[model samples]
Target: MFGELTNGRYVTLARSDLSRLLFERIKDTTEIIFGNEIVGLEEKSDGVRVRLKHGGERKFDLVVGADGLHSGVRRLAFGPQHQFEKKLGYAVAAFEVEGYRPRDEDVYLMYGRPGRMVGRFTLHRNRTLFLFVFVVDSDPLPTALKMQQEMLREKYEDGGWECPRILEELGRTDELYFDSVSQIRMNGWSKGRVALTGDAAFCVSLLAGQGSALAMISAYVLAGELLKADGRHQEAFLKYEASLRDYIQTKQQGAARFATALAPRTQLGLLFRNLVTNAFVIPGLARLVIGKEITDAVQLPDYHWQSSVI
Candidate 1:
């Protein structure tokens, strides 16, 4: 059991840490604009004219909507979010705790309750990340951070384990990132010179645990296709979609079902889940349940070298 399941191959890093590392690498080569956001886009024959919220405009040969789940670029180019966003009947609120130490510093600690989950992840020696996810039945979801915090407190106030202490700390935390668990599904990810990437195009939610990997793959394929097309965006966009759409759609389908199983809705379900994982999540069974085949559903193409990078 230990030999089959103990193979070390994956590394997990905080999203902020990864972003900061990438930004440092590209800060010198790219003209990065901070604070302002895209407000509008007008497609033309040669390029797309983009309007920022600060009354700024720029024209580019391509616009990749890597903005995220509630993407402004997706809205400007595709349409409203409701048309494409599929709510998974859950919400997650996340905050960070500085100067905290855990016994197992290298491992992720998680607990699941009926329709709720609380987890702690170590970011570094001094920093820890906390996340609280719960089932929700509300639409027109709460948008304000205060409301999200209040809702999390109200929902998990009586929760067992470390939730109470986490909630207390959450009160003092100044920054909170909250959003409904949702997947964005679109008939197509591109229109004219603009294309969507990452959470903007297809989100497998968090339950699938493949959002970041899939996004990186999307970026690589999109860039490769663009290089293959020699700056011809229409052709590149078509190829990108054709190449990855089926794989993403298959993963998205799995995510929708996995979300429910993540934090079961009933006590019996949770018990069964615990029993199954404890019994089967070992040795050859673990591989059967969750293996490389599931993780590597998409085969990445070997790309030729291109002078330009995205």
Candidate 2:
């Protein structure tokens, strides 16, 4: 089964079709089980035996943990996220700020030197998303919401440049996503028959704006590798890790560097950032730098997907 794109708008339907589509093309019949969480796993001569939370057991040839950020599977298979996650001393909080119109064509970027930046991006339609990220040196996440509101009032209260309008909207929205600008690093993506994909394996983090793309690419490659191994699951897992390892590492490095550039700590860093953005406003220069920067970050290989199960 396939999903049809919604008329006159883009819709996210992949989550709905994932499980059903995977089972559709499989040829040989296999037992399908659900609602059981694997609590323990052991290596056996034949394969791996997994213990379930519901007092159940199953021997599987392979296990894939594609679960996101705080992944339970990763904790079981690899170590813990905290061991690999690097905190950048920055707090990011974002919520929808309504009635803030920056442009009819594209989003607005507001930048300042003091480790603060606000970007208003137009979403699907009629609504804008406000993203504010700052560097506060200490544990800034606790009072992040309240601080953001104060910062908003102070920075934008008297501004004639779309800032006042944006502040008005920011005051109304209470919900937000708050976190440290961080990346996940894993030396290996495979352990025995257990494999990982997406954020669980390696998180590109928020600053690079490549997390979503990296996750999609990782999923596609992992699935293809599994199919290519021809039921030799260990080989498939290793191959998948080998292929994507370098790519993921490179992306993580890039994200770390980018986080620094976005919220530079030094006075020279602030001056440099402002000078660059302000000077590069010329259409030609702006296009050259911004285009090349983003493209370099997101550049990845094409993994063609085909159904071998049938």
Candidate 3:
């Protein structure tokens, strides 16, 4: 349950829309590459050599893995994901359907049972986004999209309250996002000439409800540190980790506790969660319950940017 926010209002934007908006801002200034993946990274004393999936290689003074949770850069730079990934015993899936019935604008509708929940929210253009969160036993979920769909169907086969319709709609859509709700913990986020940011470094998990915000915060801080160091990556990476390590650890701890709250594993847990959620209607009760959780306590450093390039 989310409490009242006195400082800022909430705005929901589809990930595709958000990606387009960010790309539009940097398209002109940044060299955009598409359809290529990083396969190998070799760090040298002077620079890092990045090997592409398509047999291309490039060298840069430094490399930053802004990639998502399953980051290849992280694997090459640090180690395998298992060494750092901490699964929170849950999986999440989401997809969108156009012209779906019972569209509720500006509101999120959710239904829950023991160990699982489904939510739906309306988007622009007569589209509705459905999100599924459920308990999972292990990592390495099905990779194929079809398998993922079947898995969702199996998980929600006995579900009620529009779940049947949601699954029926799910069959018609091609794109579905599915992954384990896990966090990445590491002793450090950088090594040699390479550094990590966003979900690659410290994913507080989706249940934390701040993955995107924290990603942006890490990126901003990493860039600011780079600027302050005048492109001296060693100094910048150290400062970047120091500035946000404690803040991120706190967020991860909170997220680990939020898994059950997101989808209660038992009926009693669900009932208690419902009672607490309903109590939020009382004035200032939501704040009193989750005031600290909702607030962004990090004191972001103020960095001045000039026309000169780093």
Q: Please identify model 2 stretches exceeding 4 Å from their true place.
A: 1-60, 102-104, 143-168, 278-293, 296-310
- After superposing all C-alphas onto the true structure, candidate 2 shows an RMSD in angstroms of 6.9
lDDT of candidates 1 onward, in order: 0.82, 0.67, 0.88
Which has the greatest TM-score?
3
lDDT of 1 by residue, 172-255 (tens): 988988888999999999988889999999988876777777888999999888878987788999999999988888888878
Ranked by lDDT, top first: 3, 1, 2
lDDT per residue for candidate 3 within 160-218, as digits (tens), equals: 89989999999988999899999999999999898999899998887777877888899
TM-score ranking from best to worst? 3, 1, 2
Q: Could you tell me how far off, in angstroms, the CA of residue 146 lies in candidate 1 after the best superposition?
A: 2.9
With a 3 Å backbone cut-off (N, CA, C), the pairs that clash in candidate 3 are none
* Model 2 worst lDDT window (10 residues): 1-10
Backbone collisions counted per model: 0, 0, 0
Worst window of 10 by summed lDDT in candidate 1: 1-10
Taking every candidate in turn, the Cα RMSD to the unseen true structure, in Å, is 2.4, 6.9, 1.7
